[model samples]
Target chain A: MAGTDTSKEFMFRPTPAIVLCEPQLGENIGTTARAMANFGLWDLRLVNPRDGWPNEKAVAAAAKALPVIERVRVFDTLAEAIDDLNLVYATTARNREMFKPVIGPDEAADRMSAHIGAGQKAGILFGREKWGLNNDEVALSDAIVTLPVEPAFASLNIAQAVLVLAYEWRRAALKDAPLPFAGDEGEPAPRGQIVGLTEQLGEALDRAGFFKTDAKRPTVMNNIRAMFARAGFNAQEVRTLRGVVAALDRRHERPNPARLRKNDDEQ
Target chain B: MAGTDTSKEFMFRPTPAIVLCEPQLGENIGTTARAMANFGLWDLRLVNPRDGWPNEKAVAAAAKALPVIERVRVFDTLAEAIDDLNLVYATTARNREMFKPVIGPDEAADRMSAHIGAGQKAGILFGREKWGLNNDEVALSDAIVTLPVEPAFASLNIAQAVLVLAYEWRRAALKDAPLPFAGDEGEPAPRGQIVGLTEQLGEALDRAGFFKTDAKRPTVMNNIRAMFARAGFNAQEVRTLRGVVAALDRRHERPNPARLRKNDDEQ
Candidate 1:
């Protein structure tokens, strides 16, 4: 995907398998599938779906993500679901008080990437729709995947939970994922241009008697230079600023230029 | 509200105005509210929902989220919807030709948090569920919030988009959301303790002739010391490691002390 107004293509990569542990609603499953597809995640394993397999409702809600829905795997238990996976992360917001390593989605994604890079199968286990993965379920996994959601409302909809994890996985796994960016408006000011601009401004300030306290002159001048540096001046911007400085520094003429010239002539 | 299974309360904050531009489905709106509420976001505005307001279907899908649903506002147009907001981010995946800055949801959330902190209102505009915001609508926004969704399936459902933005906003606002944490099992080793450990290890290593090349002894020892520094060894860990080193270096109590005495007597 190309970010807005840029030619850079965001490359897709192999992502971790998504395992839903006894998900209840067909609609939630559908939305979760859609979320995964959004981030290029295809492998989906379902552990004992409440309503049963080949759910038409889920397929309908999935809309354009039939490919994921069609290839969905059904397992009777969590162990069977993740048996093939070398590393599994249990997704839960509940503080189970178990002595398990808890990690945010980004770190999990990074670890998963490393595992996958080593040709090891990796997957993330999303808990039930209602209560989430139980303590036992959480204990079985290598790490606990949690988001810093609001404590008052930590109950993220299953699909949203999937989306957040999937998004982070995309951010970490896909090195070339197009990040939102603004194209540069103009060329950066060259060293010569910046030096010229700085000197011209310094000269103008000198004429204005800006450095009245000569003791602090260097500090003030340095501050002005730092301000310009932070402004990210382009070549054109530098030229324009220099022109403004020159105009302000221009010595004033008499009321009438011709009359002033005549007066000078008489003098 | 307390996070799942945690005593810590998730404090609510004033978030950006969530403006949905001509959303088609009532269910999607309900899900959007659910997503927003998951992250403590409450402000929701709709511009010309295809089905009229007070939709039963939307409320049903909201899953008992009446607080956010009840306070939802309706507008006739996009301009009216965001007129009260100071900064606006138009959520779009399209590469529209515009000079506006394009930022990801994380940066947008950061900017929104900063704007709201300064008492300036900010809002994010979500286009229709189908075609997304038109060029004119996108042009009016101060910036574009785009996600790197899979190009094959770039159409992220409206609720998914809202949840992503809301998630990021929550992440920015709640500085205390338990991030990925490495639970330190023991306290950091004090400088004095580390120095002692380093010297002890160095002596034992020296006795064992670890530094074979005299010229590289200092460099090798320094490298070993730096490795420990990088390990971030806690006090307990350092002590345990020291015990291991002492066990490995048990060169005293000659293995044949008792055996040799018994053998000498037998002789």
Candidate 2:
């Protein structure tokens, strides 16, 4: 078992237990554990794993997800694996004849979030790596969960399937939690910085004969200002642009290459 | 080249390209191709691949994505590989020092759809296996795309990253066939135009000494490129910028504002 970090405690939340039925390879189980850990899923139940439990190959493949591998529980039958869960979703690639409610991972996650939020245990049942779970095994599940993969290549490997499901489950569970990083433009720069940039660039363009005529200066300047406004530069970016104007402006004056480089470095 | 089915033509549409930079293992490349094919993505570009092209291991591991593996394009440099792409998103696991907009997979997919729908090329860049994209590599991208994984297990291998992005892209493109709103930014400037602008400005900056040293030139140019990419300029904006560059470059061609006034007065 790998050391667990209590500080990173999202695993303690009500996440759906991952149940693999008749999983063949220890590598799949280990990778499945890795996928689960990546999305903060913890509970792992195996119904008749071919290689049995506590497999070293599974541990080696699980990487730093030892907390998930260490806590895996093996069961003799599909019924036993999901016995304690109040709700279960059976994931399958191919369309089945059974009249179960088929739902996508997002909806499944939402339902599971609601079910687990109400203090009822829930689990997702996945099938074998080769041919998936038998009809009887799937019948034990409460509903069907399928990914929206292309019809031509619908099948997803065990770990890949687990990854998508776990990702959605965590997303649903943390509905209000903000993304790890905000898409900030650094407060959109201060209005004064924008004005300063516009004035400096407007003056440079004026001297460079970009306006063509003094009468056309206002309209052209307005267009240039509008374009800069449309770009929505941050403070840092405004500073960079000012440096560009200054560098270009210096071309009309003395050609001091060394001093120009020094000025840019200081900026 | 692997035989492809014309019937599976979702790959033909304005789909985002999948680019892997310095991918170490052929197995990962093959599985990434599989993941792309599963979600109907066909374009696969490799940059400076470690094992060379047409690898047997990649073909063996690619499962049913023979078409993708067959049509793989390899480039010696990242810039060359992404030269034709109008918009590029670089995937990174860790926080970066730059100010490119950071978005999740879903948002990235939506943005890609909007860009591609407007008749512009878009691509997602995946980095190496051991460490992700370097700062300079990321700087060439229009934006930074990150996943919503547990921070403790934030990193995803090449194949997994492709799977998530490809899955979201398919869902955004197909499932939501009718976009909520039309793209307001007319068609964005093509890659050639953007590259031309960058090159022309870079030369002007070089002569003007915006870069402090030859060693610092790449970093400064990358920052400049990233800033323009982040602006998401349209064709007209690019033209306006080219004119600005030409006007700036004319500073060495004698004082012309007085001559321009005389010509305007004569008109």
In terms of TM-score, which candidate is strongest? 2
Candidate with the greatest DockQ versus the true structure: 1
Candidate 1: tens digits of C-alpha lDDT, residues A1-267: 222222433233566889998889999889888888887788899999999998988998886675578779999998888888889998876666655678877779889988888889899998887778887887678888888665555667778888998887876776565654443336668877887888898877877788878788789878888888876678878988988887777744215577789999999
lDDT of 1 by residue, B1-267 (tens): 124424645344678889998888999899888888777788899999999898888999886555579889999988898888989999888767565567888789889989998989999998887788888998778888888676666667788888888888877776555652343235568877777788888888877888887898889778878888877778877888889777666764345477778999999
* lDDT tens digits, residue span B202-259, model 2: 9988878788889998998889889999877778889999999988887866668887
Write down the DockQ of candidate 1: 0.17
Give the interface RMSD of candidate 1: 5.2
Determine which window of 10 residues in candidate 1 chain B has minimal summed lDDT: B1-10
Model 2 segments beyond 4 Å from truth? A1-10, A182-184, A256-267, B1-11, B176-267
Residue A107 in model 1: lDDT: 79
Cα deviation of A257, candidate 1, in Å: 37
User: Evaluated with lDDT, which candidate comes out highest?
Assistant: 2
Q: lDDT value for candidate 1? A: 0.79
Candidate 2 chain B weakest ten by summed lDDT: B176-185
Report the lDDT of model 2 for residue B238.
94
